[model samples]
Structure formats: structure tokens, C-alpha cells
Target: MTYCVGVMLESGMIFASDSRTHAGVDNFASFCKLNLFERAGDRVIVLLSSGNLGGTQAVISILRQNGKRPDCPSLWNAESMFDVALLVSDAMRLVDRRDGQHLKKNNNGFHASFILGGQIRGEPPRLFRIYAEGNFIEAGDQTPYFQTGETKYGKPIIDWAITRSTTLNDATKCVLVSFESTMRSNLSVGMPIDLICYKLDSFAVTMRRRFDPDDAYFTTLGKEWSAGTREVFGRLPDLDW
Candidate 1:
């Protein structure tokens, strides 16, 4: 399993993903679940993926290999982030069409989802959660974030902390905290997390970092956040019997 999240804020957008994939307790591996397509000053597109590794990788590979498909609307030719979401959704559906039957016959399913977030040259930064069926939803003021894979473990903190006014730096901090929360609750969502931050109207990514288990800031945040949670728990009034 994996955990990937994207936050859309008035300031910009933040994207993050964990890199662990496990077939069983004894069989585990790490592969980057984050893909970035950047044209530097022109555009920056980020994809965060979750679900079956093979399926997700296949979809991404298709996007990269045949980015100019006329029928599918590939990412390279997409005019806006919304169009990019459509293109990604088309890719997911194509993958499902080709492999879904085979996987289902074996009692497996072609399960995959993605968070597509970025900005094109003339458009505002936008974010979308693309589902397995070639459909998607965009982030808006009331729902400014989207998450996939092992999402329940880490969603509460983001719900409490993220906001439209959140700064890029603070958004990064919040996403890292969310990741830390997931790693503590689920073994399947292990680190080396990929993080990308885009500032509004820049049409480029402002910051990107890889946070491994030993990264100093992540270590510090993990310790501090855990201690803070425990302290807050203790301070809350006890329930009446």
C-alpha cells in the first residue's frame, strides 16, 4: 500500500507520497510513487499515485510513452490542469480496460488512483483526484485537499490544520506531519516520502524534498508531534462515567 496526498491552498499547492510497496510481510520494496513533469518556468505537473503498483506504473508509463495520443489527450499537450486531469483519467481507464479482466479472473483487481496537481502557464494552480474509472474531482475552497491509500490514518490532522490560507512552508510541515501519522499507524506506508510545493502563479515548483526515515527535520517533527499529541490528550477533560 501507499499514502499520497495533495493540498490546494490560496498560496499554492503541496503534494506528497510514501514509497513503500509490499506483497507480504516478508516481501517489501520501495519505488517512487511521485512523478513530476516540469517545464521550469512554463508549467509544473505532479502526480501522486496509490493502489496496485503494477497498475499505477503502467498508467504512468503509458502517459510518458504516448503523451501525444490524439484520442486520449496526453499531458504534454493538455492546455490546463483540468485537461491534464482528463488525460490522466483517460490513461487510468485505458489501463483498466486492458488489464482489469485478467486481474479479476485471478481474484485480483485493477485498483489504482492518482492525485494530479499543478499549474499551466496561464492558469491558476489546480488539483484533482483521479479515480480508477476515469473520473475525477477537483479541490475547492471547502474541500481543499485530496488523499489516497491508507488515507484514514492521516486525514484527521490535515482536516484540523490545512486551510486555504496555509503558507507553502506551513503546508509542507502539515503534510510531513500527516505522513508521520500514517507511518506510525500503518506498516505498509513506509518512507522516503516525496514532497513538492508550488507557489501560486509562478508556474513552477518552489520546493521539492525527499524525506527518509533519518531525515533530521522529519525526525524532529515526528518526535515533537507525538509528544504534543500526547500532551494534548492528557490535558483534555476526562469523560464522565
Candidate 2:
């Protein structure tokens, strides 16, 4: 299992994903789930993927392979972020069609989902949650973010503190804290996390980082968040009942 999130703000956008993948309690490993397709001064697309590892990897591989062909309508030529989402959805469907039946017969899984967010030339930054079935929904003023896989544990923090107006810096902190909350509750989702912060209209990614287990900032942030949460809870008035 994994956790991936993307937030679109007035200033820009933030993307993050955990690297943990496990077959069982005794068998665990890490794989970077964050994928990027960037063309300086043209577009900056970020994909945070989750679900069946094979399926997600195949889908991403297909997108990358197709994006190189000028004859195909790929992410490189997509005029808008909506088009990019469609391209991703199409690639996902292609993978499902090829592997779904075989996986089902073996009682295996071919489910994969993605959070796609970025800026295409001319359009503002956009975010979408693409489902396993290849259909997707866009983030709007009311819902300016998207999450996939192991999402419930980290959602409350984002819901309470994030808004469309949140700054990239603050949003980055909120996102990391959300991940900390999730890792505390679920062992399957963990570090090292891949994070990217893209400023609007830059058409380039200026900031990207990987937070390993020993990463000082991430470690400190997690500790501070845990302590702060406990302190806040301690201050809450107790029930008389």
C-alpha cells in the first residue's frame, strides 16, 4: 500500500508520495512512486501513483514511452491539464485491458490509481484523481486537492488546515504532517517520501526532495507534529459525563 497527495493552491501546487510497498509483514521494500514529466517553459506534470505495483508501473511506463512520439497525443503535447488527465486515463485503460483478465484469473490484482497535477502552458495549475477504472475528477474551488491509497488516515489534517489560498510553504508543511499522521497509524505507508513544490507559471519544477528515514527536517517535523498534537489534545476540555 502507499499514500499520494497533490494540492493546488493560488500560489502553485505541491505533490507527495510515500515509497513503501509490502507483500506481507515480513516482506517490505520501497519504490519511488512520484513520476514527473516536465518540459521547461512548456509544462510541468507530476503523477503520484498508488495501488497494484505492477499495474502502476506499467501505466507510468506506457505514458513515458508514448510521450516521446510526436505522432501521438501525449502528455508532451497536451494543451491543457485536462488533456493530460485524459491521456493518463487512456494509458491506464490500456494497461487494464492488457493485464486485467490475466490478473483476475490468477486471483491477483491490477488496480491502480493516480493523482495528476501540474501546469500546462496557458492554463492555471490543475489537479485530478484518476480512478482505477480510468475515469477521473478534477479539483475545484471547493476541493482543491486529491489523494489516493491509504488516504483516510491523512485526510482530516488536510481538510482542517488546507484551502485554495494556502501558501506553498504552509501547504508543504501540512502535507508532510499529514504523512506523519498516516505513517504513525499505518505501517504500510512510509518513507522515504518524494515531494515536489511547483510555483505557478514557472513551467518548471524548482523544488523537489526525498525525505528518507534519517532526513533531519522530516524527522524533526514528525517529532514536532506528534508533540504538538498531544499538547493540543491535553488542552482540550474534558467531558463531565
Candidate 3:
């Protein structure tokens, strides 16, 4: 399992993902679930993935290769982020057709989902999540972020603290806190965490970072968040019996 989030703020976009994947309690490994496609001042794209590793890898391989084929729809040639979403969706479907039936017959469901977001030269930064079945939905003012894989434990903090007006720096902090919240509660979502921030209209990745357990910022944020939660809890009025 994994935990990945994409946050869209008025200032820019923030993307993050945890690196753990496990087949069983005894079978565990780390793999990067975050991928990036950047074209300097032309476009910037980030992909956060969850679900079956095979399907996800297959899907990405296809899309990366597709970008080089002139006759087909590809990220490099797509005019808008929405079209980029469609290209991702189609790549996922192609992977499903190639492997889904074999997996299903063996009793493993063909499951993969992705959060794809970034900006093309002429468009605003955009974010979307594509599901197992090849359909997707975008982030908007009404819902300025999206999460995939082991999402429940970390969702509330984003709900309470984030907004479209959030600055990229603060929003980046929120994602770390959100990831910390999940890591504390779930073992399947381990790290070194992958993080990337792209300022709106720049068409280039603004900040790219990775946080392992010993990283100073990640360690401090975890300790502070825990202490602050306890401090706030103690400040509330006692409940009536």
C-alpha cells in the first residue's frame, strides 16, 4: 500500500508520496511511487500512484514510450492538462487489457489508481486522480486536493487546514504532516517520502525533496505535531459525565 497526495493552492501545487509496498507481513520492499515528467519551461507533470505494482509500472512504461510516438496522444504533445489526464487514462486501460484477465483468473484483482497533476505552458496548474477502471476526476476550488492509497487516516488534517489560498510552503508542510499522520497509524505506508512543489505558471518544478526517517525536517515536524495535538487536546473543556 501507499499514501500519496496532491494539493493545489493559489500559489502553486504540492505533491507527495510514501515509498512502501508490501505483499504480506514478511514480504516488504520500497519502491518509488512518485514519478515526474518535466519539460523545463514547457510543462511539468507529476504522477502519484497506488494499488498493484505491476499494473502501475506497466501503465507508466507505456505512457513514457507513448510520448515519443508522434502518431499518438502523449504527454509531450498534449495541449492541456485535461488531455494529459486522458492520455494517462488510456495508458492504464491498455495495461489492464494486457494483464487484467490473467491476474483476475489467478484471484488477484487488477487494481491500480493514479493521481496526475501539473501544468502545460498555456494552462493553469491542474490535478486529477485516475481510478482502477480508467476514469478520472479533477481537483477544483470546491476540492483543492486529492489522495490515493491508505487515505483515510491522513485526510482530516488536510480537510481542516488546507484551502485554495494556502501558500506552497505551508501546503508542503501540510502534506508532510498528513504523511506523518498516516505513517504513525499504518505500517504499509513507509518512507522515504517523495515531495515536489511546482509554482503556478512557472512550468518548472520549484522544489523537489525526499524525506527519510532521519531527515531533520520530517523528524521535527512529527515531534511538533504530536506535542501540539496533545497541547490542544488539553486545552478543550472537560466533557460532562
Arrange candidates by TM-score, highest first: which order? 3, 2, 1
Clashes of each: 0, 0, 0
TM-score of each: 0.92, 0.94, 0.95
List model 1 lDDT by residue over 14-119, tens digit each. 9999999999979999999999988878888999998898899998998888765666567777899998887788888888999999999989879999999999
Comparison by lDDT, 1 against 3, better one = 3
Per-residue accuracy of model 2 over 41-83 as CA lDDT, tens digit each = 9999999999888999999988899888989888898889899
lDDT tens readout by residue for model 3, 124-203 = 88999899998999998999999999999999999988999987877788889999989999999998999999998898
Error of 1 at 148 (Å): 0.4
Pairs with steric clashes in candidate 1: none
lDDT of 1 at 49: 90
Among all windows of 10 consecutive residues in model 2, the one with the lowest summed lDDT is: 105-114
Clashing pairs in 3: none
lDDT at position 60, candidate 1: 91
- TM-score, model 2 to reference: 0.94
